[model samples]
Target chain A: MSGTAPEMGRRDGSFEREPARRVFASELRECRYQFKDGEDEKSPTFVLLPTGERSNRIFIVGTLTEKTRQGEQNIFYRGRVIDPTGTFFIMAGSYQPEAMQQLAKIETPAFVAVIGKPNLYQKPDGSYLASVRVEAITVVDKDTRDLWVLDTAAHTLDRVDALATSTSPDIVKAKEQYPSVDPAVYRKMAYDALAQIKM
Target chain B: MDYSEVTERISRKFSKSGKEIDRQKVEGKLRRLIDEFGVQPSEAERSVSNELAKEFNIPAAGSSGGTGAGAGGATEQKAIAQAQPGDWVTLEGKVVSLAAPASPAIAQSGIIADESGGIRFVVWAKSNALKMKEGAWYRIESAVVDEYKNIPNLKVHSGTTITEIEKTDPLIPEPSPIRDLRPGIGSVRAKVIQEWEVTHDRMLQSGLLGDETGTVKFVIWKEPGKEKLAVGTVYSVFYAQVDEYNERLSLNITTATIMQEEGDIVTATGGDVEIRGAIVHIAPGSGIIKRCPVPGCNRALSRQNYCPIHEIQPNFVYDLRIKGWLDDGEKTHNILLKRDVVEALTGINLDQAKEIAENNPLGMDEVFLQMRDKVLGRYVACKGREIENRLLVNTCERMHFESGEHAKLLNRAGGAP
Candidate 1:
């Protein structure tokens, strides 16, 4: 619902809607660092993107590979969405009842576009696992998926470009946090993601 | 109940055993068995938890509610950076900075950073927690991570504990480079490269600053006792607010303190870049177009002569521009050609384009069609500044093909061994 139209939406005076970032599943999986900007409890939780940006929400179009109803008392759905690069784990619970219902009804192997929050949880051993807390998931066409691939590739490469050129705070912080990740690697991933689309 | 909680609780069973286990993977395995294999939920949980315990060589918890590890449901002690939105984490960090409470319910709120990174923390007045002073170290236990504006902040409540500690050296954020400056208060030391004519009445001085990384345009507004910066002198500007305009980064130093420094900074010069590519596609709104006549609001008008902001303008100024895309094989760059570049590319100046639009039965679209036919798929080298993926083309010329290179390619294809 948040990403159906590209036009900017203002919810109210106090609540500013977080723009959903378009990133490849490959890049999204590597996102471990999470932060928030304001002090309000309702402020969105943003994940620090490796290429150099803070993403509160992510907009991705992928093929729904599998789905499973995970909960019993309060049912939630776990959906596996795969893009050109990798798989994005999606979890929709009672908190997002509509998304959960939508995920439950949708058949597998369908092209799906999702706009959701990036959620991360740390293991006791210190490694972090990332997934998307589904806000909205809609079945889409192959053309939409392809368009998203091209657009996401461009955005990913733009961030890769900013990693070196722009000294923006988020870029600087991303560089500091993810020092081992080479910017060229993301460039290659973007190219690889783009190659999946047939013009 | 969320299955994630069940999976996480099961995951805690292995935390003290020092065996690595993915919580989501456990949830996935459990879900697959129950949803796909049609096993009972209790059986699925038991089997999955047992499988993980056996794989890691730890004793299995008999039931889903049982805690296998000796830690026995204790909250995880974590670094400030590792804490997630919902987790109850015990963090040992110093009170780096404190701000005035936004509401009466909040007793204290500030940033707490360890060696990893910094996080904002808030102590609720209802919690009756001990007051924390800035620059002092405290061990905050059982604090919940609350998210706001996509950032994680610490919530100190009645359940949380705070203790003073003597820890040395938390990671202090360094003054970011000009390139690293986002839309926030930042400090930078750089040489004033060029000063521009003050365009606005409130603008005291505006110019370009350069350091080793890159150059940024800066504006010092007219304020009481504000000093003008001399060109070619290096100044250390502290707490300057960084803002963006038209995809380019600029600095506003109205409330900042400036001190001239001794070192001469070698500024990275030359913003012009030449990109050789084929004009892949011509975007809409190319060739002849009408713009709002209002100064500083030169937005293109709709087909009905309605400006988005100004609304229904009777008189509009004609402008010549080409919005297109250029693909240099690997990536496609958005290209914008203004009146000058459009004239050079299509041999149709603004006046000619206006005449064509006015006379043609097809109206303004005829000029667009002609321009598209002339430039689409044409191999050209455009020289300009690349800002936010758009190349503002200053100079444009058709790329010349080298005969020798073409001959070599032909030979390789026709006469190869």
Candidate 2:
């Protein structure tokens, strides 16, 4: 059954990680984590994963904390997880079958890494929501967290300088082609650029 | 946003550089550029960016958009013109007229005329009048261009290049003889034929004289230790100040100069006549007097009148009041008299008169009658300088009587003929 399980997972291939695409908490479109109640005796709480560059690429982070049942077949998990620089949303939908299964088995306070494309969700109140669709999952710790911040800062500055020097049309075109590019990335880039120059 | 927000944004943008840019300096430069070029804010911003980029090697942001190239071109031309300190310019013209010396530092303006133009050129007195031929061709060199009514004119200063060209033909048809004279200089001789004592402090004396041109009034000063000038005497006053006031030319004597009766200088043809009048109706309290009370008090005393301080009355007081006109004349002025002069004219001690007034109703009337004749129709020449429209004649030496030459000039000029 274990061999069949590995073969089935490989055949499905949805859980397979892409080697060329590097995932960091800073790069995640949305990140979230949930932990089980401290008094819970039987269930293991989910642990949070660090998201910035130097940290282990493992965490599912989001801003939403509540859980809701969708239809009768699927359960939705949502919460927020913050890296050193900022916070992002983590979400488990019906499409994230593995993440949903893991979420259901664990108690509250559980954490996991998430890999997915950034997506925008609109609420009925006319405000937009940001969350990451879960692709793969892992766990990380505090030492890894500190290095993520510094590495993220360096990478962000390079982007900022590039933006500042490029021709006006190029900037406009870059923004249009990469519609999902996080504006907060630019802000963080500017701040990091300023910090480096100050030093 | 509020001013603080805008300032914060600007500060953030400029703060990376180690040196701090004074916000006021930047604002002042902006305002000056606005005024100098008469440009709008956007245009001014672009110009400032360009100038800073070129001069300071600083990067300028957003310089592509502004008033188009033509308007900018014109503004640049004007700025270049203003920036240049010296430029060659020619003003070909005739010398039409000459103005009197403006001041010690400024050259007089000479009105010039030419086939193409007419303008005023400042000519510095370099070689006296020898270099400048009034009727001949005058070519000024290296004159600085200045603006008058938005039109360019030439100004000659100390460093100005100057040259005089020989004339093929005289440009000025009739040129008057040049004289080495100024407003405050030299001696003027005149004959004094009549005199009247105008006031106790000062006297007004006038006389006639005939030079190459004609005769005019020679108003002379009367001071202590100076010989009293007699009527029909010719006097040469050294270093007198000339002033044209109220359409009349008059001479003023300085304290350092001397006035003497020039007996040898005689008048040939008495020129025009001059007339002078005395001020009447002085304000009642506009003179000097001794206050009856102490310095700090407003009270007046009756018996043994004295200020409590030192148990003695101080001898000086100053107040302002108007006195009525005694002489009926075609024109009248408000006369000002000191209390001492009033007492002297009336021969009534003010303290005794105040006591008598308190005791008898007719005492004040008797004093008024005694002072009327002496105060009325008397010509009092005030010597003190004027304050606004009112003349404050402080010294008694300024009052003077009209001389016979003054009277004759007045009568001949159709006054009380």
- Report the C-alpha lDDT of model 2 over A68-100, residue by residue, as the tens digit: 445655567664555433456666777776555
What's the distance in Å from true for residue A80, model 1?
50
Over the stretch B14-72, how does candidate 1's per-residue lDDT look in tens digits?
66566668877888887788778988654575578668867876544433222323322
Residue B398's lDDT within candidate 1 is 73
lDDT tens readout by residue for model 2, B1-417:
122322333333344332344566556666776666676543454454445444544443323322222222111122111322222343444454444545654455544545433444555443122234454556543244444333334455432333455556543222111122223223455555334333222344444333434344345445454444576665554434444443334444422134455455444442322222222222222222234443334332322445444345554332222243211112222233445545544455567555554566554443443343333323343333221123323332213322343333323223211
Lowest lDDT block of 10, candidate 2 chain A: A48-57
Give model 1's docking category.
incorrect
The alpha-carbon lDDT assigned to residue B412 of candidate 1 equals 30
Q: What's the lDDT for residue B278 in model 2?
A: 29
User: Residue B85: error of model 1 in Å?
Assistant: 5.8
User: Chain A TM-score of model 2 versus the true structure?
Assistant: 0.50
